[model samples]
Target: MATPIPPPAVTVEEILAELDALDDPKMRAVNERHGNDIGVNLSQLRAIAKRLKTQLEFAQQLWATGDSQARLVAILISSPKKYTAEQLDTMLRETRVPKVHDWFINYILKKNPESESRRIPWMDDVDEFVASAGWALTSHAVAQRVENLKIAELLDAIEAEMKLAPDRLQWFMNECLASIGIHYPKYRARAIEIGERLEVLKDYPTPPNCTSPYAPIWIHEMVTRNEGASEVT
Candidate 1:
């Protein structure tokens, strides 16, 4: 009585084809029109490329984060290439039972001849597109969710460029911070404190009609200092 489930749509060959596009020099056309050739421009281009890679990788990463079936689907859908029917069935079954081997082999075998789905980076990889998108998305998403109209698209763009996984980025920053030869504990402690502060601030509801505490106060501290005020508002 129930409708036969539509086939799990993507095919393996399609995945393999999609994986081939990586590092395609043609992708450079996206930025070649910018016409800048300075060191700053080179750095900017490098950052742009890194974001594209991260967004692509994170599309796969999202799959790894969901429920097992969902995760497996994510992996198949976003991975650089497809798995063999045996491999895919194995992964699907493993989503529920890690060691089970029994499967619908004939159907799988028949389907395996052309299992690849069309590679759809523009469609499948939202993260890559997302990384390149301007800050309007952030202001819209943030304001809609939290209702802060103080949105600055330019500031959001800067923040997005600056964002990174702290632990990972800190691992790199640690080397430079270490070169100064300051006591490592103080360095680490300061890092940890900043991390803690950021988490608290981000998670705390941005209070209605309240500006960010970390934002610079409007009243000039120079005026307050002349008035001999401490902790000037």
Candidate 2:
């Protein structure tokens, strides 16, 4: 067998240079519209990540002092599996914008082995970002069909506290509710009942041929689609 090639040494300065090379004014404008504000595009970030390979320590250093672009790269490069809850908490504390929040949840928090352990407690956190991360992680768990989800507990939470959940967390909590209703057959009826009672996202606009985000309607549509898919298969 051929000898394994060693990964190149990547310094924070070198990573910054790559980000500097990839900055685009137009792309920054577009990203700003979506709440990213970071000048580097996803493709550029991914290319840099590919080039540098994984360096969790370096990534952490970059994230601590870097601009939005550097932070984005840090998220891309960091190993979620290695992150302690305290470290993750610090990152979540630093997150202010929606784009970075989205990336952290999808790329780091959701993928971590400790994600479920971190979710419910984070939801109880008063900090908006931490709570939002919790809801987002829960939504992800539901979508990925993780076993033994607490459907009754989730339903109870929705009924007792969803209406009063933090502003940033409402959307993800709504998503978690819909996901439970859609994926867990036994709890479908109760979830749907709660959705109807809560009516979250009832008036949210939906594009043509798109399902509304209203939990009851969203759950019904997903279940229907799943049944149709099963029949065809």
For candidate 1, the 10 contiguous residues with the lowest summed lDDT are 97-106
**Model 2 misplaced stretches (Cα beyond 4 Å):** 143-148, 208-211
lDDT of 2 by residue, 93-192 (tens): 8998787888889889877787778888998898878888888888888878878877788778878888877667888888889998888888888888
Using all chains and alpha carbons, the TM-scores for the candidates as numbered come to 0.18, 0.86
lDDT of each: 0.30, 0.83
- Residue pairs whose backbone atoms clash in candidate 1: 11-115, 11-116, 11-117, 12-115, 12-116, 13-116, 14-116
Error of 1 at 21 (Å): 6.0
Please tell me which predicted candidate would have the highest TM-score against the true structure.
2
Question: Following a full C-alpha superposition, what root-mean-square deviation does model 1 have from the true structure?
Answer: 20.3
Predictions: Cα RMSD each: 20.3, 2.5
